[model samples]
Target: MSDEEKTPEAPLAAEAKTDQVPSSPDSPVIASATTESERESLPDLPATESFSGSEPESEEADGAAILDETMSVRRLPRGLIAQILAPEDETPVWIDPKRLGRQSRRDFLLFGAATAVSAAGVWWLLPDGTKQQWLSPAAASRIDSIEARFGVTGQRRERFLGRVLTFDDDVAEALYSRNRRVRAYRPSDVTPLRNNYNGRTPTGGYLVSWKLTLSGLATGKETTLTAGDLSRFPVRDQVTRLCCVEGWSAVAFWSGIRFAELLRAYPPAPAARWAAIESAVNLDGAGQPDPYYVSIDLDTALHPQTLLATKQDNRPLSLAHGAPLRLVVPMKLGLKNIKAVTSIRYTADEPPDYWNERGYSKYDGL
Candidate 1:
């Protein structure tokens, strides 16, 4: 069985191997041969010039040219025929193994970089992606959306900013810093006061004629006192700056009795946490009687700098600058320094303020 049969395939196997290799490595390898005897003889052409003629122009080879050039191309098939057929720019040179390797590596790096950057941007834009100390991610995203034209509008902007303002107010109270006082400057540091009357400006000279009313005392009684009665308590003065909600400030010298001493003379009822102050009736620009009123927490009423001022820069109070008595609380913005000889009523709940009702902050603290 052995020797004859085994050797039978040997010669033909070697011949098949050699035949499978095309003349040009770049061209398609054609036709499989099951056995050497299956090979057919190609017919000799009618007659044609040998390709040994000047190699035809590398111009496009049509079907006729393909038959004529088949011999030449087989002799140098390394894409020569393809180059002739393909557009100059689309010539399949990029398919070369080494060049394709470099192009693929460069493309892979660029694609990876772009994908990573896009993913990070998407993460930051998501509402819950980041935890921040000041602005929440949701707020940040809304702000970004508004700026980036993602459909957020001015009304939405206003709503979020209102929330931001509320949060801003909360941050100050969170420190539990009621005891922290403002820096007091020297008398020489005092500057001229700026006129910032809201609804009405009083004409000068209510001094001596003015009286202060105190109500809702612990005894449930009300008392009235003149500016002179306030001098019975500690009369003190300090140079302090008055900051306004309108973003301006003035330093001034004010002399008055410490409001704490006044509270000692007439303590508020046990449940009272706020003191409401009202000015003598003053008319508005339209000539209507516009009331000026505000409230302060009892805690603020107790600060050392809280004063019932009867004088400024050594002169008696001018009615235009709140004659006879004006409450001076430097820890608050200029608005809290209620003007005019007025009444102070103690209450358990905050009283409605003139400006607060008109959109100013209730706690206007420094």
Candidate 2:
């Protein structure tokens, strides 16, 4: 049969009515058409595109119009919007190697400079010479006043240079009556003469002989001590311990005239600040004046305990110890109390002390 003849004819009125009406209770119902305004108010259905190669031009135009409308509705470009919403990628900033190294070097240099300045300041503040602290200002001034009124300046340089002014021990023995006394020995009947003759001056009254020349005193001429002058000064006795810097100690009974009394006999200049004591022995053996000199302030010189001892242990001093006149400073160490004193000088400046020159403490006092 032909294709046109095989096609079914249109249904009769009854068959069409039956098809339009619901055949069963589970059948879906179809909406009836309304007015044009009502149809316009209904929600628009989504447009569809055909996948067939021969698409209608109107359909393509409609699709392009929709895409343009959607693009216009966006507030920003798609790429910009995506970037704003995307997670951030972070990178670390690196420090310059050169800059770090420079900072380190600067810190090191600053530290070193500070240390050097501190060291220099300490060195500058240290004391230069051996002037004792107690003899510094007020004490020295008092001594100067006494020296200026009564003390005479002597030849101090020769004493440091080791010039020995010798005297006979027999004279010292005759002066000290105890030297002639004999001690009885229980083992033998022989009585031995109490002679301690080591050239050390025993503790007793003895005259200290030294050439004193004062430029400002007595018309600037040399003044000599007369025998009568020795007789005028009264003698006193004292017992003191002599402590040497070398760690030796000895107790000796010293007999001498007070240094203050002797100073009153001859006066020094008013400008005198320190009293220098010089020993006859050049302890350093440098042919220079005895290096064993001590510079005392005026107050220490005038102290009641200061003496020019001529005897020791109730006998005339031996030569090995300081004979004749030796300085006895009770408050000071034995080294400061110079032995064999040959001269005394009063000066404004501090004099060189013996042990201080040998790296010992200058303030060697009790």
Candidate 3:
């Protein structure tokens, strides 16, 4: 397919406890990001492109904290739709005309019941105006009040409110993370894979000898294995939607060894709460040198749908589609589903994210 037609892929996140918002190595950011301009001066990436998360951007006046998320959850194209559908995450799982009427009565009823419970649960937690239509306007009104008192207007006002509001939305997503598993589909249902990226794929020559390295194990030991070793582990195949923050999604069949198998082989330290997946040198949408990475909660990484994806459809992945090895986690947004994974490190705190530093949500679970 042509570049314009193919789905665009984005950046990922990953850093050790020393930092949660990983800045671009060569960015001209001020050391003390205490000032709003200093914080906003980060990457300022687009929404669909993670590897670089480009949502809200905020930080404490002290600059001693994670940059506040101002554009993530609230800024996604499907954020409103996800809220409108009244379900957990931004996936409008019900909007697939292709899957309509494909389920038996039992499955359909179960899905409906689950969605209802999720809606009620969130409603009870967030109330009517917090995240719904009333949110932005209400926030605007409050910002107006602050402006009258402090003469704040234009971008400053937006930064303040954007940070506050997106933070609210991010909290809601992280809190319940409803245990609703996305529906799996048959191979026949697979659609053409869609991906867009500013970075070039790792050369096919390197992938021919690529191997996944596992470290930061709870055991405090590290090991490396070749593709042949991974093949020995039990494999999982599922067709699921890869949802993008820009609001497009596509169904694709992914085949790979379950992450659980790898965990069993290399258990994380009890203190390790996040898995910081690192990748080769790549470029961000801005064409900056982006050592693309992302750190996901161990819980999210261990979800059954998550995979150390080695194949898309029935064949080996093309370089354009993250050849050799990539992450395929259906529950998280596409950005979190990192491509071209080179190493996996377990960290005590959330690792710095490429996009989080660039002004997107730190926890962009779908």
lDDT of each: 0.67, 0.50, 0.66
Q: Mark the regions of model 3 whose C-alpha exceeds 4 Å error after superposition.
A: 1-179, 284-289
lDDT of 3 by residue, 1-366 (tens): 654345332111111111322443422343344333333323332222223432333222223234433223333233446536653344222223333333234356878999976754443334234544655867745644554455544455446655875786577466634366777888888777676676655456667667778888877888788888888888788899898877888888999988877888789988998999877645566655568888788887777788988888879877788777889988877888888787898999989887777766766777
Model 2 regions more than 4 Å off: 1-222, 226-228, 281-291
Instruction: Report the Cα RMSD per candidate.
Output: 23.5, 40.7, 29.1
lDDT of 3: 0.66
Better of 1 and 2 by TM-score: 1
Going through the candidates in order, what is the number of backbone clashes in each? 0, 27, 24
Which candidate, 1 or 2, has the higher lDDT? 1
Residue-wise C-alpha lDDT for candidate 2, range 1-366, written one tens digit per residue: 654455443222223233333322211221232232222211211112111213443344323433332111112224556746755433232445655465457557878998976754443333322122645656545544444354321223223222221133223323433123212122233222232222333333333444322232323344655434554788877766656656666556678887778767766567766777776543333334433578766556676677777777657766556665677876566677766675677777777886667555554554
lDDT string, candidate 1, 208-267, tens digits: 467788998999989988766777787898788899888999888999988888899899
lDDT-based ranking = 1, 3, 2
Local error of candidate 3 at 142, Å? 21
Local distance difference test, candidate 1? 0.67
TM-score of 2: 0.41
